[model samples]
Target: MTRAFLGLGSNLGDRMGYLKDAVAAMDDCVAVSGIYETDPVGGPDQGRYLNVVAELDTSRSARDLLELCQMLEAAAERVRDVRWGPRTLDVDVLWVDGETVDEPDLVVPHPRMFERAFVMVPLGELAPDLAEGWSDPANGDCRRLGDWDELVPPASEGIS
Candidate 1:
């Protein structure tokens, strides 16, 4: 199985709820980084985003992972009325071990992952080796909110 990283964010409504639901939907999820609240990078003006990077050990290809990301976003009722616009949930296939996919809809190792602090900070928390020597990006402010377990409500409690 290849070890992959998925970046997740939500800002429209119940940001944390959207994140928790996405993380819970991944059957191969192995680890999740601490949450980071960051200013939206681009797109019409929008609220801050709650973000995290999740690790998964899976046999799925990069294309498959991209599909999964889209599925999660759809489940959150994400609308695409505007480019980089406010989203209920945003999921990206950040990296996939030993794989490179350059497709119209997907790109492995996310072309902009390294340029965004929201992605780098939490990613550093889970895989420092890949994030070593990485510093904050100039795009926006990013601050750690807390660990995933502490910030997200338990499934048993339900999301409301």
Candidate 2:
């Protein structure tokens, strides 16, 4: 199985539920990190986001995982009318093991993953070894939410 990283966020509606349900829907392939509440980084005015990073153990190829991410987003009623707009849920493929894929529809390593605090914090918690190379001057702004430990689910509840 290939280990892949996914970033998830929801700023609209019951954010926690949107996140939990999205993970629950992908029963076989995904495991969530501790959730964090983060300030908005870009785009127009919007609410703060509840974010999490997930590690997926799957035999699915990169393209297949991309499709699954999109399906989960759509299932949560995400719309593309606005870029960086608020949504029910946002699922991004952050990394795919050692592979690097750059395409019009998707970019593995998530193009901007290194720069986003929301993506980095929970990711760091789940994979400290992988997080090592990622922590640099460029990622200085990333901050850990104080209640992070409290939000992490028990290991028996999900893979982490």
RMSD of each candidate relative to the true structure: 2.0, 4.3
Report lDDT per candidate. 0.92, 0.78
Displacement of the residue 126 alpha carbon in candidate 2, Å: 1.2
TM-score of each: 0.94, 0.84
Ten contiguous residues with the weakest lDDT in model 2 = 140-149
- True lDDT of residue 158, candidate 2: 68
Compare the candidates by TM-score and give the number of the best one.
Answer: 1
lDDT of 1 at 8: 98
Tens digit per residue, CA lDDT, model 2, 1-160: 8888888999999887788777877655455677677777778899988888888887777788789889999989888888988889999888888788888998887888778778877888878776787654444443445443366454467655
Model 2, global lDDT: 0.78
State the TM-score for model 1.
0.94
Query: In candidate 1, which residue ranges exceed 4 Å CA deviation?
Result: 157-160
